[model samples]
Target: MSSNKQPVINKFGVISSSYYEKLFKCNGQNLYKSRSGKSKPSYSVTRECILKFNHTENLREKERLKEQLTKNILRCKRRLGLRTLGSGKHVNIPGGWIEATYLAQCKGDIQEEALNVLYDSLDHASFDYCQLPALFFVAESVLYRLCCDAFQKTYLYSVEMKLAKIGYLVFLRLFVFFLHGHLGGFKAHLLRLQQYLNVLSLSEETYYKYPNIFSNVAFILKTSEIIYERVLLSESTFSPNGNTEGYENVYSDMEFQRHLRFNQGGYEVNHLLWHCVAAWSCVQNNSPKLNNVLEHLNFHKTQLQNKCWLDSALALLVLAEAAKLNMVCLKALMDLVRDFILSIMSAQNQEESYKVNDFSWAWNIVYTYVTILAEICLYAATSDLRKTVFIGFCGCKSSQKNISLKDTVSEDEPVLREASVLGLLKYFSSKISENCNQLIWTGYYGLVYNLVRMSWELRGDEEQNGLRNTIWQTLQKTKDHEKDERIRIAVKIAQAELNDPTDPFTSYGTKVPPNVGDETLSKYIGWRIANTLSKLFFPSIDACAVPLKKLSIKQVQRKYPKKKEDPMKKRVLHFTVREHPSKSELSMFPYPDLFTRVDEQLARIVDHHWQEELKIRQKEDAICEAEERKDKELKEKNHFKEIMKKREEKLHKQTKPYELPPRTEVISLESKERNVRKVTDYRFSTKIVQLQTGILKLPPSAIQ
Candidate 1:
């Protein structure tokens, strides 16, 4: 592998000024299909009538208009059974993005087209029952766009803030079904959303003062991206006409990137091995980006660990794989980690306001950090990395000087003596055969190595099992390892990758997977070497994305808590904390019926038509059910009659009793003697076959 060049990121986070896109993706998705998003007939008619009535002062004229309006509304309601407004007549859109953006790539075009039609209708007005999936998609897109627009205009986002909040509930449920787990390509779509989150959490001030939805779906998506960008990366270049699933490939796959978006994207491999996709992208000829992800972490918050626990832990863990970028990066990371841990232990002056319920993050942080250190240890164990590199990476040289054992221990707290040293380090170190009797600690290398070794032992855990297997296959270079499940399902997946490192802007079909619609061979030794060296490791990047829209919701909810159900009914209730919530939770709430008179009339008409159709279907189902029941009854009767006839025949054949009673004389000998005399009359010697029938002689009730 060739040596890596150090990236020099400017204050703008710019590493290179080659052919590329701007910092923020400002190109809007084309949704303008040039078709009129016409208002509902009922809405139009009612609105016109009200306008006309308002203009007239004559009592007789007013009364006549009102009557006429009522008649018109009724007529519209009766006709709704034949046609529903939401069925069509929405998107005759003119712009390109509605049907040809990243959202509509591949087979998703048709689904997207239908969705756009509904979005066009919804963007004009409000109606929930008209269409649900369309609303979900549009609302999510709107929420993302709102954040992006905020980045563009900054303080000018006040107008749509209310609308965005209302749409958040809709956006919260991004997936229609959880069973199929992230079926579409959300890489490009989620970038802007994550970027917005990063801006909100530039500091810890906004996070604690305003508890938001950071712990909600946004963080889940952030983590999922980390795994995806790190694990499922590809070296295959991008293709404009990539989607070949029968739909017109109208999507434009031009990717606009920068350091800001890169940090938000996740992961940054180091100079020791190779940079991750985003970091490497900074060196592109046409367009280059920087690896300035470290700037995203909150150093101030990490310094005060106990004050901002989750944020600090996350910042540290995110840089686990990244510390090996260089000696400078490694040293800075080691110092930060050492200081963060010391802050957790020696916080005697800080107040303990948290309860037991809020203490799981500390354990989770330690476990995760130890596991990452273990991966580094494995790298060091092999000749892949030097122990000196791991030294700074593991913070072995750093020591907690100011806070000694005596500073932590006191006469007032007897337990302080036992808690002087962290037990996790002690037990974990013993496993690696390290001496723990030394007071106040061993050197940084010993402590970090033990943690890493413990991580190696615990690698058998279910979560890391698949990664281990993949690493083994890579090392062994088995033929089966080439057959990844991703390649098999590649045809089904949306190949509209605009920014993945694997799917680059240009390619020579060198590192392409075997037979992925490609007839190329892996004979190029140069290409193999380049691809092999690039896959050595990936950098763990963290942009500290936290959703801030929830702050508005929290402010509102806190000021006016949700109302109780039927306060009048509960005449007497037990005393509670803060009863009778403040009134008017929603000053601008958009109820379906809260539209203008025209829309309300239209809603009524739509409801009436739906009811009429439902009634017709219900009647049809009833008739079908009755006919089926009648047919079943007749068939049962016929079957019963056949059984009865057979029973009557056996009962009337009284010879059965005589035939069975005289078993000795029963035609037991149908031999040659009987054959010889068979010519003569033998009416009483007839063999009975009735015994073989074994039919039940009881009625249905009797059997029961």
Candidate 2:
């Protein structure tokens, strides 16, 4: 062998060189090597050689090896008196005998002898079967087989002991997984047991004969209950650690456990088990002596509710089943649930109130109980009995003012909670026909309104459609048209479909004639007529009517005024009347008529001002032209005066002005004074006319 051929080390860190040499040499030869002379080998050496030879074999060889191994282990146990009580023959035990015995027991029927053999193997103080994973696997398999085989037998102490041992083994496996940080394995083991129990429960023969199976069933239930309680209690505390806070970690751990249990059939099994136990106890004890069972169930329920964790709905359902089994004390149990529901519904303070998600679970529980309560009432014989129980359950006075439809749903309570309460009332009404009239009327009407409004708002989609139809059918039963306006509104909205169109606005097919009498019809019509008349002619009716007719007459007179005798009088009449129309006519004319008159007068004023402005402009033009001509002449005269002055100065410089030339003066066709007066008069007249028209011609832009 080369130096690089490294030896394989065990956990103890030392490899047996001879062991490897024999192994490699056997591999090369495809045959085993003997320790001494090549004679028949010792039993241990033969076993090792067979194992090494069969390591590469297929299924046929593997099964052959398993049978051989089983034969050897059983032979050894038999020789040592491990299969019998007080036998003197003793034989040394082989390694892996525990696992071999477990497998052998699982492969066939576990008879008394096999059980005795297993017991003897396990009883050794130095036995290490529990530490071996393969031993657990083999033991679980054998236990499962044993349970199936014994499930049909009569109650025997030995069978019960076997079951107890199997259960203990299962528990040990779970604990090992937990301690070793193999949570997945732990959950898988739990699930495996859960499935095993379910199969056990399904066997009616097992349950009927072995009433003590409750012990094994209780083990599973109690394990789940304990884990759930820990989870619930943990959620209420704070965790300072990083992975999860204190209570949160507890919750997480429990939740993980719960997932295991639930996935493994914990819910169905535990609930059924509790009821089965209670029922069996009832029959066996010949009395409702379920205090022990009830106490255990209640402990978990109280924890669930107080912590507001775990599915309260599922817990309540289980409790209700148990309560049903022990019906003698059902009222007290029911009262406890009722109080829980009411307290959750009434939690108004922000801190006290359950979170929205929590409330959903709480409501589910309450609603379920409410349903159960209704069933109980309906099954009662007499109306009086039903009524008494219903009133007691509701905790409201019979004579108290019923909640009206007009009263808004409280903000603190969920809509589903309100719906549930109404459902209860409706149920009570159905059960106690004679005494439930008031409740029926009030509850039915309120429900109709709520459902109708909810439908209109499209809150619950398809669900609300169903509710709307239900309310309609319910309304038909009561036929109380006077009290329920929602019914009336629904009818009116559906009236167009009296002929039964394919669709009604209410979407409830077509309207069916309500069973109302002529008296009711007459009263309804009379009320409508009175309402209309009062709205038409109430306070100050005379004042409005008198002004209306007088204004009409004034408008007629103003629109068709009598022809005036004189033209001047006609013009004055027209101007004065147009300037300020009659107030009565203005007020009475429809808004459009008043607007038209104002528009015409504004147009006329604009035209008059336009003409006056044109005349003033012409006169100004004439006067400006005349002034320009005069100013030109004045300029020429000044130029001539300058020439004369320059000539005189030159002449004096020589001798003197010799008889100054005759002075020439420019002339005009019209006098400046006369023209100024004519222009001023023209400007004044234009100014007066413009001023008068400007007073009448407020801008159309302003009106707009």
Candidate 3:
């Protein structure tokens, strides 16, 4: 509520402040304090340390606690999977999967309470800590499971149905957490998880399944460690016992098996998904591995028919990756890409709501498609990017084609001048109009790179200079108004690439010009392409740019009717905290939303904290002002004292008498030493040559 620039810290309204204060206060204390002369449970110790790690005010203390826990886990692993007290007492919390079972058994209120505890603990975890990413992974997995449960029970109209909605909020919060931390270390988890599942095989099921079945917690811990290693030491080593031959064997033989069923729970899908990801990871120019993956992916195209949205999104990403590898002919792949885009766009149109669930994979799909489009523009053969095709193949409406730019070719031409460029821009602009900020922000960088690259590649109307400028200006506005620092930084980097002269867009310092050597430029281009696509799955802040429109501004305004507001009409809907009913008064209502009450209470706490913070700020400002005034007076007094000292010194100097120089005497030199020294000296002789006289005579004649 206050305009002050300081952060507001609300005092706890329902929960006591000491609850959090005690967490921070017990930074280095042993968890098993002798309460009634008996030590506490292992879970208690773990929870206490985790809380301390989460809330400790001192960075050094937080690190010490984190290192202590890490050491404990490492020691437990080293001791033949036995928990022990080596340097200090340690505890092992239940793994995410095991915890899920316990969560399922808990009653509704207990589950909500437990979720809140986990939320608070995970929310406050140090962003830079090595363990935070794995923690987020576990937390998200658990939250997803909870969400599924709530969704399944929603039809029953039980109290638990309301709890399901909280999962989405938790998901949003978790996403915001990553945004704040720049999604630190999560990429490695993604990569490692992909690698682990990629090499897993039904043939070696016993090896992988035994540990997971018997001791799931340890398995989870081991997986977390491997992921952390992969993230922290990416180039140091590779996963041992990868099933390259087995994966190929399964891909080749599994489709024809008589007993093969598509209903293998989520395994078959996950297996395929991981393989696609791994193949994408291992992609190289004209790679045989990529070719094989593409063959397998083509075989499973039918399997993609009934898959869930998340799995479909993964398959699409793999397809985009394969496209980048140039595994197939451009024309055929372009048609496939266009058809897929059209299908997704169609699905989006048919959907009535653009809620979180409906738009879950929207960003990922757009990101992948944009990346593929960029790749086509950059790396496709000259014939591919510039080849003219019937406008029907691109799925653009006739009206869109009719609205032409000033320099565009005639509509009677019957074919697109640059089919790929026109199609990609039209689709991109439509998607931009949908107001999916996450999708736009994620894909904006790659779009910029492609636009600049295409601007260099294409000339005249096909160059799309106006669209490029508009998109860049849109991103500029988003960057200026965006709240999330991570997104702002990413936008700034993208802008630097597009607008900064010294920042060569490609890593190899390849200038954005045509006819550059492809070998060096291609590698740098490949990296930018890959990195641009990778950051899209993560989310970010919304944009403030005008919605992209297919029609010209003048035409659009002409089509729609404008209305003037009546100043006499009164507004109907309004809310104020003062108008809210007290808890006692609300108890008589037949149905009351507890969630709304909690939200209002939290808001009240925030307002109170803001007012308190404003008062503190005002006090601090008054103190500063007094100090400044005192300092000013002191400085003036010093200046005056200095001036007076100088004047006194000047008067003292002016009052002093003049002085005179003393007389001195000079003595004459004696000649006795000159006669004494001549006794030991030898005489010197000199001679002159006769050739000089001849030269002087010749010179006089020459002058005349």
Candidate of highest lDDT:
2
Instruction: Write down the TM-score of every candidate.
Output: 0.22, 0.22, 0.28
In model 1, the worst 10-residue window by lDDT is: 516-525
Stretches > 4 Å off in candidate 1: 1-318, 353-360, 380-704
The residue pairs that clash in candidate 3, if any, are none
Q: Which residue ranges in model 3 land beyond 4 Å of their true spot?
A: 1-336, 352-357, 380-421, 430-449, 453-493, 497-499, 502-704
Candidate of highest TM-score: 3
What overall lDDT goes with each candidate model? 0.32, 0.38, 0.38
Separate clash counts for every candidate: 24, 2, 0
* lDDT tens readout by residue for model 3, 1-704: 11232112122101122332222112233223333536442221233444456567897996676566545433323221122211112322222212322232333333343443333222222222222333444433443343334334423322232222223223333332332233333463344333323332221333221111112222233333443443444432211112233355555432222112222120123344444543555454334555565555555543333324334444444444444444353343455445555544455656663342355434444444454565454444443232222122444444245223323434443222222544554344333422545443444434443444443333223344443343334333443444544344443433332333442222322434432121111222223223222222211123211111134344567888588789999889777767886777665433435544555687798889999999999999999999999999999999977776786687754221343422221111234455555643422111123344453234567668
lDDT of 1 at 386: 27
Total backbone clashes of candidate 3, pairs 3 or more residues apart or in separate chains = 0
For model 2, how does the per-residue alpha-carbon lDDT over 28-82 read when each residue is reduced to its tens digit?
Answer: 2312223243533123324243333335357776666566655755564654344
Over 10-113, each residue of candidate 1 has an lDDT whose tens digit, in order, gives 22222221101111112221122122433221122322344456567798987786565545433332322112322334322111112211121112223233
Better of 1 and 3 by TM-score: 3
